[model samples]
Target: MNKLPPEALEHVANYFRTLSEPTRLRVLNVLGTSELSVGEIAQLVDSSVANVSRHLAQMAQHGLVARESRGNSVYYRVADPTVNELCDLVCGSVARRFDQVVSAHAAFVASTAPARRRRAG
Candidate 1:
């Protein structure tokens, strides 16, 4: 891969920052491959319409989402398809780490069980 210049790196960082919010990620997940109005997205994400709108606007500005006006409502969809791929990669990594942690904890508990039984007896 080619190295990015300092300014380009900053832009990349800002783009990642845009996706760093839980609400925005939820909005993307809610959107998936379908275009939905702000109200519909808000209901699906269990957030206030106003709050979802704000997040949608921010995502739109970042070029992460696209919006269209239909009658009185603005509908949104994911603009950068690669965003979903990126999220999937991160989610897989997180799941692996979580499993590793759980396994380690279970092993620790198993190891301590015998000692505890011995002490009690």
Candidate 2:
């Protein structure tokens, strides 16, 4: 198997590190839809503005997102459209897996439980 060069490996590692947090993922999800101000994203994600701003800053530094200032508001959006696609793909897969797990658990429970007779009038 081929291995990544040191610089490429470092870049990939940093990218994964940046995406390792829940808040960062949430921010990316929200930004994937459309551009929004920091306050708006914070509200949607139920995070403090300061915390959201910090996450945004980190993402912007990593080139995962881009920000533009309009008067007093700063709007942020996904830097690359592929990012939204990637997030959607991963999240959809997770949702499908969770659904399968729940279905299997329910089936197991139903099969193990004894059938109860209906009460006579």
Candidate 3:
């Protein structure tokens, strides 16, 4: 990224920005698993067909997803498989942080339990 020119860096930023939306993330998650029609994606994402189609169009433009037309239906899939890798890395980091928080919370409760019991007794 430091090696890239300003214009290329801006494009990279836009690519990440494209994935920042919750709905777009959900759409990509579904595509990572299987190719689906816009309707199918809409159903799984708990959104409307029109809304999902709009998201797909933008994602396709960004080269984040691929679209295929079959008769009256169109299907979408993740164009860059590396996106799953990126998601896995991020999710793993978040999961580790959550585990740390959970462990801390459990330890705090254990430390306070004896104090609470003594007060009651």
Candidate 4:
């Protein structure tokens, strides 16, 4: 990225922007496991089929995922394996941070509980 030209940097930014949507992220999570039809994805994501189809189209346009046509139905799957790796890294980082936050909150509550109890007694 540091060596990328201005236009290349812009393109990279746009790529990240495409992954920034919640609905798209949810769709990706589903695709991470197995390829699924738009209706199946919509059911899992609790969205309408039309809405899921729109999300898939946007992601497919960005080459983040690919779709297969079977008869009249389409099944989407992760196209770029690197996207899965990127997602794994990001998700792992977030999960670790969340665990740290939860632990810190628990410790703070535990430390304060004794003080509050002492003050009451």
Give the candidates in order of TM-score, highest first: 1, 4, 3, 2
Each model's lDDT comes to: 0.94, 0.89, 0.92, 0.92
lDDT tens digits, residue span 1-121, model 1: 1788988888888899999999999999989999999999999999999999999889998899999898988889999999999999999999999999999999999999999999999
Candidate 2 — which residues are off by over 4 angstroms? 115-121
Which residue pairs come into collision in candidate 3? none
lDDT string, candidate 4, 7-121, tens digits: 9888888889999999999998887858899999999999999999998888988899999999998999999989989999999999999999999999999989999999999
TM-score of each: 0.95, 0.82, 0.90, 0.91
Which 10 residues in a row give candidate 4 its minimum summed lDDT?
Answer: 26-35
Error of 4 at 99 (Å): 1.3
lDDT of 1: 0.94
For this target, which candidate reaches the highest TM-score against the unseen true structure?
Answer: 1
**Over the stretch 19-87, how does candidate 2's per-residue lDDT look in tens digits?**
889999999887776999999999999999999999999999989999999999999999978877877
Query: lDDT of model 3 at residue 9?
Result: 90
Q: List the residue pairs that clash in candidate 4.
A: none
